[model samples]
Target: MGRVPVGELSRYLLAGRLSTNGCLTSFRRTPRSRLVGPAPPTLRPLRTFHAAKEQPDPTHQQVQTPPTVPLRKKLKDEAKQARKQGKKKSNADSQTVEGWELTVGIEIHAQLNTPCKLFSSATTSFNDDPNSHVALFDVAMPGSQPIFQTGTLIPALRAALSLNCDIQPVSRFDRKHYFWWDQPSGYQITQYYQPFAKNGHITLLARDGIAPEDGKSVTIGIKQVQMEQDTAKTLAHNDNTQWLDFNRVGAPLIEIITEPELHHPRTAAVLVRKIQLLLSTVDACVSGMETGGLRADVNVSVRRTDDPSQTLGTRTEIKNLSTIKAVEDAIIAERDRQIRELDAGRQISSETRGWSIGSTETRRLRGKEGEVDYRYMPDPDIAPLVIGSDLIAHLKQSLPVTPDTELDKLISYFGLTPKDALSLINIDNGARVEYFYRVLYSVQDMIAADDLDGEGADVKTYAALVGNWTLHELGRLTSSKAGPHGTVDLTFAPDGDCAQVPDAELSQLLYHLYRKHITGKVAKELLMALYLGELEDGVRSAIDTHDLWFKEYSLEEYEALVDEVLEGEDKVLQEFATSAKFPQGKLMFLLGKMMRAGQTERIDPANAEKVIRTRIESLRPSAA
Candidate 1:
């Protein structure tokens, strides 16, 4: 029997080679000391001899190797270390609300804006008859092999590039096994093992009261973006049964997983919206949460500042959050729940949960599963995807300027403030941002082509005017419900009808506004009339019919209106005569009456004030 040192004991136990039969079976290197005796006694701490020994064997000395922990134990230890590090890092500088430091990571699934499904030729359009878009391959019919859609690849690539991912040239798919009613194949074909993109990052400028006035750039880490198929929709009936609508089955989807870097719910919500805007701008996905085109899974956890090196609190995964409010609300509720648990001395359970929009609370769904439970394996039927130079080039060309890039350009190019630029590209008006740019650039192009010169017709002013109207008035007309923040979607109204106003009419209205033909108010009225179909005749006809043109009254005409006001108001003239300090006060009072008497639009209010003041001064007696 050989005397194994204390450090070697961990290795032996981890290796599982120290059998009950008293034999060391697994060893990478032979020990310097050979086993020469029988079974040893109970192990104890090695004692050092203070007295000098003759020819002492150094091999018998207690030389300890770094303990070799078991693989599972090692992983657990590393996670424990990470949690400690995460807590320390979090407490070092993270913002804490309600005495709890919040940590959140969002996983978003955005349906690719593709005509067909990811692995089959089924239509990906929504609002079709139930099961109408399902193909044999979509339902996993026997002997039905999936053929990948090339169209779906482009959007994924575009999203990956826009999100600052390093696109892997060689990516493979794997089958994730799970038993669910919606998943017909009993497994999902996904790029789980090796995703198409990895290690990306997004810089989020906190808005919507997420940070200080000078909002910090919160850079969230993107873990990976994987291509996967959507499961079918399950509609529960009154008879305690369910019907499967496979229209969404096999639909192309990309899942973006972020690191646990988000600390505020508002910041997390804004980040989700920003990602949605980026995807929509690049034509990667529709990014409509209401239409089931986008979904988010949020992981929320909390810890304390006192225990900086303690493990992070258990996390709860809130699944399938369809709206931004849901994401924010769920995070807040979950974090509060965790804080309450901590305050009550209760342990938080790691579980999966569901959010009820009506109840506005997270309820337990099931215990969270480890990754090994999915049983991932490569799909033999499909080959690995190879993204070559040509495809990359094409994808790069196809992608529009990303949201951040566009925001920077708008701030620099148009001389707009960052807040104003962010307002245009905010998620609420994401879909309409391009339309605004189109109208603005069209005005720019016209100004260049015609070389127009006017008092208020500079490119910057015109661009600002276009942005204001497009983001404000036009957005209101196109949205079903306009709130203080603006609109989220303009494609469908409450009646399920498209709320799109004609871009041509909008362009014409902007032209009139730029050329100083109509005031901003008049332009708004014209837009409303056009949207309501009350003005069929184009922009000019609408303006002329409604008498919305900017009115310009001659100095003589304004003076006459002022005189009429003065004659009707003897009391005002008397007040001015007795005051003697300022005769123009009486004339200024009369100017308001003149403007209200059918000259509001006809006479410039400033010009009226000037003329009335001049007349009053001319009539004044010098020092009498």
Candidate 2:
């Protein structure tokens, strides 16, 4: 049977369905009218539900909620309804048509954390001067040969293992021939045929775009992880002359391919960010998208959710997406494009596209290339890469604790809530995580050293307090927009170095807070002092210098101060002591005056409230 126009099919299906009596009533209630287009013989629905089972049981006689309509179908139905009603359609309605379920898969290229290139000894550091760190082998010199960097494999292995991939026993390199101005070698070395690892999955929690019933996790499948060489950078000169920076030519990269398991564009973006944080925990990649340290290529397709077979439609590849926002925007735009084509009875072309950052639309780059087109051949120059059991075992032992594991440990061991634990980890930026752990262990050390006050110094409580300070108070101080200098000083050390604030100083400040020697406000001031390098002698010195130490007063003295404030303001006391305002707890307002008169140092708020309430009851004549 030949394909029919979508418009003709829609009109015929809708008109003929009304003749079926109640059979079409259910169809009308659905977000879209079902199409009876000819499907391929093999493309049958996977399963069928009986009509009796689909509808509610007659005995119950209760109304049942219809299944949720796919987003695409809902859009199309709304558009059709607007047209029939002679109303103007909104821009969103004009942008999309119905009946498509979007599926997205992402391929990520992460630059490895290594001192040298993958197949050469040349430095891989970014330099101000172009071509300064190039090796003869990088530029394809006649006599220079490739020597593999075995040390560089550690970072890649750690990444694959952390992602729960199975490391292959034997992997080999292949030459992908491509002629470009940036590739002096005329080919890239990659593990195309037999990659290093494969078959992994990640569970994405519904932290965003979720409803009460939609709280289940979304698991995405990983296809493979392969080691590859990065391309050189091309810089354009003033006269349109192009210069190549060979410094990055042989740099290491790990390419991760995922199955088409993502349904929403934002979900895809969130998964990419999670992967970035995971890799950062192991130092596998620098995890910076702006500097080309990481990039993603998105493959998007759409299908009919109501179709039984759920056959995937033709897919488009969006390449070199450098940011998470770009990934999401490109996928949504491409999904809309495909739906519009299908609704008009046109087939989507399988092609590679580039995302125009300014317009946020995709433009065709080239027809999508198949693996056969690359003519992949085994690299004769390099031997087959083999991993012995002993080496694999050692690498597994050396793998760092994954971020998810750390989150769990923070919760279970420290008795912290999931929110507080996540705040301590700070997945997007590990600076706060670093500070948290440093202070945490430092406080523990001080306790072990028998230096703490030892009365109310609980490790779990201190850990929670540290998380609050780091994420809340310290977070604001360091935030670029909120800070006084337009940036918070997160500088503990320079880039690529392990910089942490002094543990001794941090421990002292934590002790002060735990012992209630300083309020939370005063604790923040102490942290600022330490950050600014003004707390040279330690927490005590900072407290003295800033006059932030809490002042202690005798119990009798505090009671006298409270009595004086209430006695002096007789009218204020009468209003609070016996009026209806007493129910509103207006006595605390006058108690605040007593604390303020003593500089808020001589009395703890809790103690002051208890003492002032007793004094007020005596004045009420009930105590007499």
Candidate 3:
């Protein structure tokens, strides 16, 4: 019998070994020394038998060879070798954490700011009547199928490209099976095996008291991003029954999954906010927590960095954190819970947990399940999405400057500190900062054209004043009514709401007050009146209003007010004449008193101060 090579032995054994009857079967290449008989005719061609008279017949030597080893022994040896190799490799690479390392990843679900749903023509507007927007596909009724919408895909692609992710030309969709009262279909149509975009990163801003500089910074790596349909919402009742609202069903949504890179819960929270801002800046999504436009599923796994071989600790999914602060709180609470469990020699289980806003703690709802539990399978109705590069490039070109780039530009253009620029840019409604720049540029153009002189007016100071008023006072007014951080969507028209106040008028008001053409009190009063809608219709300039409101007084009227003050306070005049410090102290006091009296009579306070100063100077020279 021929011996087989070790690699070919499995094939021979699988075909069955030689039969017990004297029949050759499953003939294999046998080891040369293991031949048990005279050389076969097949072997005769390869080697000729030579006459060996003195050393016995060579044929006898060939016949004396032992039979091949049994197949069972060979199989056993192979198994032992495999086991040995596995053990050696495991010993070298396996790491152990004192406690299990929790492997956490996040899945963020954000609603796209589209005019319609993913698969229907229903208007995607909020606050609609329940079930009014439902289409046959949204309800998953019989004979209804999904159709691709370019509006949905374009925005998602723009976001993916902005994040620097590789767009998958062909992406598959699958049905994710789960039970929820709101979902009439019993499963959501989502992308599973393949997704649209993958492998991107984002940098999150860290909170104060955590770490300064780069200590608390988090860089989250994305696993994939997919376009999907949002599930309907359930309105709950006290008796465990629920009311279904299909208004949100089939809303176009982008689901972004992150790798298990976040080491701390706070980091996860911070990372989510960064992504939210990115989405908002592109107009891809609104990311409003109050409006349910954004939601996150945070998975947390804990493992010691020191141990490489130990399995990671079980992770819990923190469900549906709406606000950034809530996200941070949820993460910290979960970390503390897991750490306490490990300290007590208790193991953390893989489960889904909810955050209690009142107590700020995680409450386990149910055990987490693997992907198979969803029974994901390709959706038979929809075909693979074929994305072209041209569309992607166009979208990229249309995108506005990114937040990071805008931050740097703001710092240089507005002469703002790094911290202030960052703070301003982080705001979701920060378009006002951009508006301020537009106005500043207009002012600069006016200065260059010689329409206004830049001598008495400092551009930097004026810019700061405008930024502070917009960011602080105006922001407060609008936010008080709309919500915090909100501002009126102003159009910088000449006479429209939120129109730009003219720089010349502002400068002129300041100049008059400084030169005593108008009192400081009168200038402020006039400015407030104009701000409160006192300006005439079709008014093109603030200077006209300032000149119209300026009050002129005769020297006799001013002198009378000054004399009244001096008569009532002879000690002040005496001090002005005798004391060296009286000019700055007592003499200024007399001037202020006279200004007050003049202001009551609609006279300019600046004139009163000037007249009083001149009179006191004349008296002082005589007294000396």
TM per candidate: 0.72, 0.74, 0.64
lDDT scores in order: 0.76, 0.75, 0.67
* Model 1, position 253: C-alpha lDDT score: 92
The TM-score that candidate 3 achieves is 0.64
1 versus 3: better TM-score goes to = 1
lDDT-best of 1 and 2: 1
Model 1 worst lDDT run, 10 consecutive residues: 41-50
lDDT of 3 at 439: 49
Error of 1 at 138 (Å): 3.0
Mark the regions of model 2 whose C-alpha exceeds 4 Å error after superposition.
1-99, 143-145, 206-214, 356-359, 415-420, 426-431, 447-456, 480-488, 493-501, 545-548, 557-598, 612-624
lDDT by residue for model 3 (1-624), tens: 555456445534643233322224313334456767543322221112353434546675544434455557878899999988764332112222344444558889989988889888877867878888888888878988788777788778877876778898889888999887767788888888899998888766543212232374556688899988887878888988888888889899998999887655445666676677678778788555656899988887676656798776777898998887777667666776787887789988988999867454699898887898888999888888888888777887899788777766766766666666665555534555555555455555544555345454446655554455445544443445535323434343322124534444444444444434554456555555444456554223444544544456678877777778888677767777776554676666776776666655366555566788898887674643
lDDT rank, highest first?
1, 2, 3
User: In model 1, what lDDT does residue 609 have?
Assistant: 83
Residue pairs with colliding backbones in model 2 are 45-308, 478-488
